[model samples]
Target: MKSNRRQFIKISTLGTGGLALGLSSMNLNGINAAYAANKNEAVSDEDLTPYPTYCEVCFWKCAAWTYVDKKGEIRKIIGNKEDPHCNGRLCPRGTGGIGMYHDEDRLKNPLIRETKEDGTQYYRDASWEEALDLIADKMGKIKKEHGPECVALFSHGTGGKLMGHLLKAYGSSNISAPSFAQCRGPREVAFTATFGEDVQSPERTDIRDTKCLVLIGSHIGENMHNGQIQEMSDAIDNGATI
Candidate 1:
């Protein structure tokens, strides 16, 4: 499965440059500058500190330098220039990490339910002990009644490591990720069959140094992938073919 996925991505890359160009143009700077500036100023590091980390916005897992305030709050996230993949550039989604972490509607605690009935859902704040106990109990019941094979686990990108461990420990073989079905599955499959090797990211394309970029369906100006998008802009500014 892994080999097939890699092949598909390789072929797609040859043609995707065009598609990226088109996508990048639509919404690249639609964000209001004043609003963005105000939001930045409002972030307080007293709540969290920007820890040097990485982002999982896409499959690349770009290295990031995060600003965590004195209070342990994450104030901002920017790509690490030292990282070979992103090189100090970040997509809008990654730049918006502060909003995600501070979102009021986000789940902050474990939830347990006695039944699946609507409105019967009662949430109680739980300690780690309580949460683990509940999970273990449920897993035991599930294994005894439905068998371990009945369970399926789905996750994506980098943070899936922990979930992968949990699934393996639970003895379920039904694990899947949407990367193949959603973004790069077709490209990967094609590349693997033809070449017998996967094209890991930070793919060989050195767009920053390229003389000409032929974009097929990719909207390069709009859908932002930090390094690629920035290179496209520089190419245009320097009058390189798009």
Candidate 2:
């Protein structure tokens, strides 16, 4: 309880990763033996607390339950049965999202760049107030030097919506998200040009009911498209030709 940050981080990282390593090294019989030996040490499913959440591993954001033991340690992640996107089964990435939580290298604090006497640059952890003040100061200077229109924003995910609004209110209309460059923008343009309609999120493809599932260069099952992959499987089971 009195451990320093480094000690706490080390203990947490090892504690989280130990299970993964143990399972990975064990075969079926070894796993069974290990489980039998530690049966009493294992937390019962009913005892573990379940928290409803959404997977942040990919854009699909499948709904899930994060199970935590009495000690507040993450036990596992499982898809919510009622979630339409997952249909009770999460993708591999979604199931493994706990790795992000226990990742040792993830940034947990703000850092500011500092230059040493040797002209070497390094990052030093800064307080939230310091970081915010520095950002405000820099933004003020930028606004004074160049018009706000010159400050273009590149964002992703739900947070991008708020960032876009902030940038626009700052007199900049140059807000862009990854969808514009990655796939959505081009796909929308092509679809509108050909079908005279724009494709929307939770796309209207209806892969599960389609007679023909065409793939030019797309890999629905191979990627993190959880819902689409499930639909593709359904289509194949129903005699749809790929």
lDDT winner: 2
Span of 10 residues, lowest total lDDT, candidate 2: 1-10
lDDT of 2 by residue, 79-163 (tens): 9989888888987667766655655444788999999999999999999999989988898789889989889999987788898
State each model's CA lDDT, in order.
Answer: 0.65, 0.74
lDDT, residue 110, candidate 1:
74
Query: Residue-pair clashes per candidate, as listed?
Result: 60, 0
For candidate 1, which ten residues in a row score worst on lDDT?
Answer: 1-10
lDDT of 1: 0.65
Best by TM-score: 2
